[model samples]
Target chain A: MKTYLPPKSTLIVWQIRVTVLLALLVAVLYWFIADYFLVLFCVSLVLAVVFNLIYFPAFLRCYSISVNQNAIIIKSGVFIKHERILPFPRMIYAEKQQTLVAKAFSVSALVLRVARAATLTVELKDNDIAEIMKAVAKWQ
Target chain B: MAVKLKITAHPIMIFYYLKPFWFVLIIPLIKAIVSAVIKAEVNNVLLNELFISVVLITYSVIKWKKLKINISSDFIEIYLGVVRRRYANIPINKISTIETTKSPLDYIFGTQKVKINTEAGKQGSADFWFKLNVGDVKKVTELYPEKVTPKTIKFSAVRVAVMAATSSSAFTGIVLVVPIINQAVRLLGTAVTDLLLDRINKIGQLFSKFMPPVVNTVTVVFLISYFIAFLISFFKSVNFKVVFAGKKTGVFSGLLVLRKVLFNTKSVNSVCIEQTPLMRFFARYLLRVGIGGYGNRKGDRAVVVPSAKRDEVHELFSVLFPKFEPADNKIKPHKNTRWRFYYLPTLFLAVSVILYLVLSYSFPVFKGLISFGFIVTACVLAYYYSLAEYNTKHSCISVAPVIYANYTRWSATREMFCEHNRIGIIHITRWPVDKRKNTCNVRLTVRSEAAESITVKHISYNELTDEIKSLYQI
Candidate 1:
């Protein structure tokens, strides 16, 4: 089995956009409070570099996700690598969360709660959730 | 638990009598007498004494009017207060513990206080200390047993009897001796007063007139306090009794005004045998029960055990809770964090003391020495406690999906039971040093009695990983 992008990419994007907006607003507020807040422009650049350090590779790995017949495994965590496996039969519920920005971006969530209560979530197009949910149900 | 088995918790009748009644009244009266003597006024002495007596008598009468208690097989009910009568009726099933307390004071007066607590709700018990008129506690404990007390309970009755007699002697002697100590202290005060006669006379004059013989004021307020304390003590001692009355499966026990309480051996989560440093030196121990709920979680003062001798432990426990074994071997926890040398509790104290001495002008030498001594003592004590904890901890799986972690730290062992299903999430944090050592720490999130998630620490990195996978069956 191959795990696709999460069915809630649009929702995740909306959340990220909102977060970014909040950060920008805070930066503006800091600028109003202290003139030296402009130095944080450099800090944000450094932060963006740090984010991409993990996120870029993780995104690539996520696209290439594959697993055995029983489970779809996602390998992550740099120092303590975790191989999270979601067994199809143990999948109890699945959902997609979408925010306005994510809807505009056409991204949604493919969220699944396994019998063990471990949450397996992947960001993807909203269309992927129903298909994935149906396929997992049929497989189970 | 037979249908015919009737039980009762005797009413605490002593609340009607003045508590340390005379001890409370006498101090102000004495101060007034002393003032009157110094001033050479016989009328003032007589007036103060009469005023103190009136207050004591009025209090005793009010209490006598307020207290009423009764019990049947199903319930133990109490109606208290002459003014705003407060009523409480506890069903027999709600009773969680029946404790009989005897102080040195209780033994001297030939009385014991019976405290009965029930598990009606999560916060389901109150201690009602009553001087038992008769001494059969077995009759009281039989009312509520997790099961009936089994007759097979091992008893060191000989040892228990000896200890009980010895303990009982000291309390009475102490009460009787209190007068001697009071007089001696008073004599010392008198000598000091004479030496500082001119100054003390002026001070006494200012204090004497202000001491209106009201029930709650005056520097001699402490006098009435002790009088009340003495009365409580005498009442607790008079009919002091605790019996190791063994029933079919549990032990039934209480002092004079009988109370039958039942505790299930299996139901108890942990038992804490404790003492302050002072009590530890005296070899005195207090046993406390810690169950799974939050209601009984935090308390330092517990019901006084009839005796502290180790030999009588079994007999007492048998009557209280038989399923619980004093030497339970099933669950013991391993010491993962034992490097006290790495922990800077002692160093911090020493450094702070040194800093205070160097920077502060007030009694610097005394503070330094005291702080240094305390730090050294605490370091040594903690090292020992950590070692003991290591030896006594072990974990076992008795109930499915529920693991019990038994820990003995600070001479008090507590067992924590956590269900695998109850774990919300696991967080593994690695400090810079830990990362170098490849030993990460695990935090398990559990919903405690308050229903909010509580994160518990100190599980090994490898063990946490193993537990995670084990919880999920393929």
Candidate 2:
């Protein structure tokens, strides 16, 4: 985990901020048109609770992982739980990413795929992803 | 003998072509309603509809004129479209199947429309084309003027009788009246209930009160309604006339548009027949042939020879391929690769049944039917498939550039014979469970598609690798 720990990128923080902003925008829309503030208040509480439930433990379990071979196992979800075991063998492509919040946290993720590599956004230190990409592309 | 065909739109038939105009008129009515509701000026909206209708009518007329189609001893040629000026010439011998339809336009006007599908080349695409009346349809047939066709033999009388009975005048009229029949049934039910039981709002109330009895009655009515549609489909599918002459093979059939399609034999890509569960139950089935033509749309390209009794598929097959006949008796599992394809589907069913039972509380009725059918059919099919696979050891499959399978009711099973030489990319898939099992799900790519398509399923990895090595690879 220490050897592979990511140098958090500016992009990760940007993305997190963008997502949060979009969520708050939706929250604010409800605040204006809603006949009752009670429903809005209730919805916001539920959102915060759900978000915390999804991210806190999941981020902890996943953010500390490194693998020499095989796949990264991301454990997530509260009620409808899932484990995404992504194999390096299926890695057709890869990229490095960063965000401000992730930089603050000193963490990142990596996305890898065989077909649609664009969809597998692996958030990690730019150097780690560069090393991973060089190794994976050798198969092709 | 084929008589030459020169098709020209009858001046009177132009009125029949105006069906699209109905839509053209609808634009204005909608515009007027919107304009009135919003209190906007109506003139611009009215002018737009007028301008649009003129453009549509002009385009239709141009399409009618440029569509130069002719069937001769040599070939069938169709020149189509206004700006593109695309022309397709399919030699008579390349014809796989020809289908003609009679839209309500032709039905009312006593005219018929033709959609001819030939095999191999892209040229055999059917256009919403030039009109032919009943006599004109027959005249179009005469255009294929050639003499002493490939050995005239009287087609079986039983076949003729079946065709005639299916498409007899009364049968056709009733078949043609299906939508009306449905309307009539609804009307009759309302009329009878109104006169006998209900003086006021009563049908729904009665049904809600006498729930089971009402449910049974409605079920019976719906079943009959479905049967009526089936009967109509059967009738419409009959009365086919297949002609094999010098270079041309043509089919003259259809209730509405008596059609003739001619193409060469070499162009035929593939042919298959399917039996629905209902068809299997009643021993009556529909025969669909996919030819190499623009039959890309839903029903236009496939010829539906409906209501053939079981194994009576042999009757139509004679017209289609006439060369190969599968032995009548049940095949030994070892004889073909069909058995190898059965296991994955069976396992899939078992897994799905388990999933549904787990989820059934959300939808009890859906869950019941799913688990019921899955548990029952999956067990039986799995057993048969096991026997078939065990009995028939690794058998080589024929390669087609394109392959098709007979449609079955209980499951989705397609057979393909894609030419290994032409396949651009290949995928060998195995799920987590399948990896231990050592079975490969083979998928092959086509040029036009974005990704590879599943060509076949459930062959042992060893057998699959060997087959790919020996046949597909050098």
**lDDT: which candidate is best?**
2
Cα lDDT tens digits for candidate 2, B235-350:
44445555657654555454543444555443333344543322333445444443344354342233435446646665756655554343222112122334545656667766
- Writing each residue's lDDT as its tens digit, candidate 1 over B346-416 gives 56556656665664455442443444445545655565555344433432222225533443334333334
After TM-score superposition, what is the CA distance of residue B60 in candidate 1 from its true location, in Å? 3.5
Q: Can you tell me the DockQ of model 2?
A: 0.01
- Candidate 2 segments exceeding 4 Å error: A1-140, B1-7, B23-98, B102-111, B116-128, B133-221, B255-263, B279-288, B294-427, B432-438, B443-456, B469-474
- Report the error of model 2 at residue A96, Å: 51
Q: Give the number of the best model, judged by TM-score.
A: 2
* iRMS of each prediction: 21.6, 20.8
Q: Count the backbone clashes (under 3 Å) in each candidate.
A: 62, 50
Q: Write the per-residue lDDT of candidate 2 for residues A1-106, one digit (tens) a residue.
A: 2235423343345446645865686678777876765666677667655545555434434443344455555454445665566575444333333344554655
* Cα lDDT for residue B403, candidate 1: 39
Docking quality (DockQ) for each candidate: 0.01, 0.01
